[model samples]
Target chain A: AQRVTQPEKLLSVFKGAPVELKCNYSYSGSPELFWYVQYSRQRLQLLLRHISRESIKGFTADLNKGETSFHLKKPFAQEEDSAMYYCALSYSGGGADGLTFGKGTHLIIQP
Target chain B: DAGVTQSPTHLIKTRGQHVTLRCSPISGHKSVSWYQQVLGQGPQFIFQYYEKEERGRGNFPDRFSARQFPNYSSELNVNALLLGDSALYLCASSFGTASYEQYFGPGTRLTVT
Candidate 1:
């Protein structure tokens, strides 16, 4: 079975502090991991994907296949970074069938 | 161009009633997918339609159905609604079947009494 787990339901950090949201997945094949964020009064949007290997809004995530983890990290957290984040995974089949999502983590950046 | 759009931002219905939620995909997008997001939970895939054909469906009952028009717009219909059916119905659209990035709408909040 394919599953994504976000252990923390809520996380809080002071501004300018580093932030890390943990995510783990269970899948048999190569997985495509993604980070999605939802801001207040805004629709859910893509934050970054592990395959892209590019940073978005100063946030980055690395896919560690050995541990089956794709953790999202930011060197310094900002108040605006407080939002609900979700971790998603897609198989390498190159289609819509592979996408699976985690429960979600709420990050609170306290000023 | 506008992003994905869903109609009736909020709706109220009773149990055993039927309701239809409409969605318009982003301009030039050919694939549309529907998801159900309950309170305090992540969204769950309901249906995926590309080129007016049903490509995939999640673990939902037949009481839930959907159709996509030639213009790529879509509608989701739920019949014999149960109290558990109350949720936020989200619509997402992408340019092609292979496009991994999907734009989502604000979603329609359905309240079943």
Candidate 2:
């Protein structure tokens, strides 16, 4: 069975502190991972994807295949960054199927 | 351009009643998917449609059904709704099947009594 696990339900940090949200997955095939964020009173939006290896809003995630982990990291947390974050995984079939998501983690950045 | 849109931002229903939620995909998008998100939980996939055909479905029960029109918009229908069915139903659209980036709508909050 394919599953994505985000152990931390809530993570709180100071405005200038570094943050890390851990995510791990169990799948038999190559995985395409993504990080999505939902701000208060706003729609859920894509924050970044492992395939692009690009950072959004100073946030970056590195996929460690050996560890089966894709942890999102930021050098400094901002007050506006406080939101619910989810980690999603999709198979490499290039099809509409194969996307699975984790339960999500709530990050609270304090001023 | 307008993002994905869902109708009936909020709905209240009673047990044993049936309900239909509508969604309009983003323009130029050919793929649409439906998900159910309970409070404090991640969105669970319900169905995926491409070119007006069912491409994939999640592990939901038969009580849940959906269809896509020629224009690529879709609707999700639930029969004999149960109290546990209350959730935030979300609709997402993408350019194509391979597009991993899914734009999500604000979602419809369904409350079952």
Docking class of 1: medium
lDDT of 1: 0.90
| Model 1 chain A lDDT-worst window of ten | A90-99
> For each candidate, what is the lDDT?
0.90, 0.91
| Per-residue lDDT value at A7 in model 1 | 97
Model 1 pairs whose backbones collide: none
Instruction: State model 2's lDDT.
Output: 0.91
Give me the TM-scores of chain B across the candidates.
0.97, 0.97
Question: DockQ scores for all the models shown?
Answer: 0.56, 0.66
Per-residue lDDT value at A57 in model 1? 92
lDDT of 1 at A52: 84
Model 2 chain B lDDT-worst window of ten? B94-103
Off by over 4 Å in 2: A92-94
lDDT of candidate 2 at residue A90, scale 0 to 100 = 81
| A1-111 per-residue lDDT for model 1 (tens digits) | 778999999999999999999999999998788888999899999898887899999999999999999999999999999999999876644366535778899999999
lDDT of 2 by residue, A1-111 (tens): 778999999999999999999999998888889898999999988899898999899999999999999999999899999999999888755477736789899999999
